[model samples]
Target: MTGVPASAAGGTGAKRVPAPKGKLGAAAVNQASLWNIANILTMVRLVLVPAFVVLLFQDGGYDPAWRAWAWAAFAVAMITDVFDGHLARTYNLVTDFGKIADPIADKAIMAAGLISLSVLGDLPWWVTSVILVREIGITLMRFWVIRLAVIPASRGGKAKTLAQGVAVGMYVLALTGPLATLRFWVMALAVVLTVLTGLDYVRDAVVIRRRAIVALRVAEAEAGAVEDSGASGDSASDEAGESAAAESTR
Candidate 1:
């Protein structure tokens, strides 16, 4: 239920997750206003970030009641993250703003969750650091190679996001005994997936970037060859005309 939109996924990966059903649908979605339901859902997630953070720290940051409220806020944000992308794709409500804002909202909430947990000493700093670096680094990598090609989201990427959301959500609450130990293992798996998926993205970006560069060079070379051929023909025609004129004058 919680994941990044394929459209905005540098981490989620390239090629929109749900393909527009038809050409008309695609066109309509592209032209949809920024204020559509999908974009609004994204905006809602953005607003919830601060609300979740505030609630997380309330009542000395350890009160179960306050943590429950914070978890509610986080849950709402995650729920909206899912609905926004689905509605946008299914109803042809996609917009440029949605594409840009959706992922940002996703990252913002995750960052808030991780940082707050770390700050409260509930989660270790290194765990948060590793995940954040992967998330942020892959995000930056997406923009870097965007002009060349989009990297499609792999199954691994989806798994990574799910593991992360579940892990973080578990941590958001005050768990005990078996549940607490379970969360640690889940977080461990999330970390592993995070690192593996990150390396995969790096490899894909490099490959795609290389292919784009090679394609561009080949196109340029062919165009230059065509121009050279045209020039040679023009020069021959000119010489022929001059010879004919000289022969006629003689």
Candidate 2:
């Protein structure tokens, strides 16, 4: 048998794959540049957590000077949290990475600070426990639903963060002598706000969960329909081929 030409065999007939297109390509590009200002702030918050821990435990066990430094570090971290969002919204720099990292950073710092203080006997264990449970629970919930729909931070969530920051700050300041009673009162108000905000987050989570369930069901139904349509098309093409074969035989 004559040898097949190289071009006919494989040289020039190979298909050229086109570059990626549409929303998938766009999403890939977006994901590639996920790091931004908000993410940087989140990283800063994470870094401050260890510093706060060291100040609370290793460096200067709730001493006035150390406490002041701790408070300042915490304040700066919290301030970055606020500014990151402001910059993200104002400058249109919001990214999926920022959305994920910001809350995680908040929870990490708050948990570290609260846990350290509780260990040091500054904060009551029950109070820290409640806050920690809520924070951790909500964070898990957020992760579970993140793939379906992004749950933006609610107003109550923001208030909760503010209350926590203020309360923790006052508690740290209380380590110093000046205005100890005033700081105690401030902390009490912060506690009240914290409780209210916690409840609000619970309510918001319930709504988000319900919405996520609905979205999931809708997506599943759509996917199933597409699969069924594809199967039907395959069946029709097979039937058409059989009919053509019969006609040729006839």
lDDT of each: 0.91, 0.76
Model 2, CA-based lDDT = 0.76
- Model 1 lDDT tens row, 34-129: 777788889999999999999999987999999999999999999898899888877778777888999999999999999999999999999999
TM-score between candidate 1 and the true structure: 0.86
**What clash count goes with each model?**
3, 0
| Per-residue alpha-carbon lDDT of candidate 2 for residues 114-207, written as tens digits (9 for 90 to 100) | 8877887888898888888877777787677667666677777677777788878777654456666666676676667677776776777778
In model 2, what is the error at residue 111, expressed in angstroms? 1.6
Root-mean-square deviation per candidate: 12.5, 9.0
Q: Return the clash pairs for model 2, or none.
A: none
Give residue 60's error in model 1 in angstroms: 1.0
